[model samples]
Target: MTLTQRQAAYEAEVLRRWQDQSDGAHDLGHLRRVWRNCQTIALAEGGADTEVLLAAAFFHDLVNLPKNHPERAQASRLSARAAVDWLATQGFPAEKLPAVEHAIAAHSFSAAIPPETTEARILQDADRLEALGALGIARMFYVAGAMGGALFDADDPLASHRPLDDRAFALDHIEVKLLPLVHAMQTTEGRRMAEEGADWLMSFRSRLLREIG
Candidate 1:
């Protein structure tokens, strides 16, 4: 199948599986963006397998768990297993399954598994990109609201005098996790993109603080 055909098939499967999921942050659009980011990073970095990256990107969030779930850290591992099993049934290349699984499994920040392959690193970087910039801001607040968290600390929005608590304030998540992701990007291209996205996040935060004050 052509790359476009394969992408459409994968997306269809993902949508079928996620039909009941209520988390808008991890929806089909998010998966498509991750795949696009993977392709961009892979093109700049080179040597990544497109097929592996495509499968990994589409299936990375197969087992989407809530941020506050007790097994949130295991979601990526579970997703990898589920993805491999489903792909195996669909006649995907067996030799490439390990790479796809590793990419999906290592893509999660909470899982903390290191990406050992180029595809894995690209997937990790691509997924992390979703947690920055304009889209990141929207997802951050959406997730915070889903978890019953506040928008920001009224008096200490930037956490100057107090410790950052993302659970208590959605704005604190940019400092606690999003900004740090720029340095955490595995590929050089990914880092460059992440830096831009992080800068945008910072600008948004500045605007938000100014408005609140």
Candidate 2:
């Protein structure tokens, strides 16, 4: 099968599995965007196996867990295992299974597993890119709402005088996690893209603060 055909098959399977999930932030659109990000980063970085990156990107979130879930930190590891098992059934190149598994496993921020291979590093950065810029802002609020969190602390929006608490306010998430991801990007291309996205995020925060004040 062509790359496009393989991606389509992966997407169909992912959609079928995620049909019962309620997390709007991690839907099919998010998966597609991550795949696009992967391709872009891989092109710039080179030395990455497209087949490994493709499977890893599509299946990295196979075991999606809510941010507040007790097992959230283990989601990526579980996803890795699940992806490897499923890929084995699909007759994926067995030699590349370990690489795919590592990529998916290390892609999660909470997982804290350092990416060891080029494909793993690229996949990690690509997945993280989703949590920045316009899409990041949308997802931040979406998740906050689902978890019964407020938009921001109206009186102290940027957490100037108070401790940052993303669990309580969506805006705090920018400082708590999003900005740090800019520095955490594994590949040079990913870092460049993240810096730009982070700047956009800062501008949005500025506008939001101004309007609220």
Candidate 3:
């Protein structure tokens, strides 16, 4: 099959896999959101191989479970191995294997998938971007909602460490996760986008606080 054909098949198969998941945190919807964000980053960054970029984005979080779970599920790596193997057969040259693996491995925040290649870094940035702004708010709330009752009642731990259930984690995410994305982004372009997004989150969170007070 052609590279395009392989990509389409891979994407459709992953979507099916995502839909079959009952997981709240790493659902198919999360995959779609991250993939979209990746496309945005890939366009801005340019120069990196597009096929490697998209495949990395699409498969980044395949085996993510609870944040507290082990760094990489053996299963996660295996799943990636399988995907990589399939890609190899589909005209993805052997030389490109590492690039695909690099991007796929580094795509996960959970996996400690260090983004060595520019492609991997762009894919990582793409995944990170989804967790900010209005998209971020909705995404957090979605996970918070699925995680159970605590995500709502849970307050930001920076204010006070109140045992940090799902709720507390969500709150800490504001200051720890969302607030610092601007600095965490690697590329200047990524950082610039993150800065604007961070401001949006800050202002929106402020509104929520004022209304509650």
| Each prediction's RMSD to truth | 0.9, 0.8, 3.2
Q: Give a tens-digit lDDT track for model 1, residues 1-213.
A: 887998898889888888878888998899999999999999999999999999999999998999889999999999999999999998899999999999999999999999999999999999999999999999999999999999999988889999999999999998899999999989999999999999999899889878888
For model 1, the stretches where C-alpha displacement exceeds 4 angstroms are none
Candidate 1 lDDT score relative to the true structure? 0.93
TM-score for candidate 2: 0.98
Candidate number that wins on lDDT, 2 or 3 = 2
Q: lDDT per residue, candidate 2, 56-101, as tens digits?
A: 9999998899988999999999999998999999989999999999
What's the residue-level lDDT of 150 in candidate 2?
Answer: 99
Error of 3 at 66 (Å): 3.2
| Model 2 steric clash pairs | none
Q: Residue 76 in model 2: shift from native, Å?
A: 0.7
Q: Residue pairs in steric clash, candidate 1?
A: none
How accurate locally, in lDDT, is each candidate? 0.93, 0.93, 0.67
- Which 10-residue span in candidate 2 carries the lowest summed lDDT? 14-23
Candidate 2 segments exceeding 4 Å error: none
- Candidate 3: RMSD over Cα atoms? 3.2
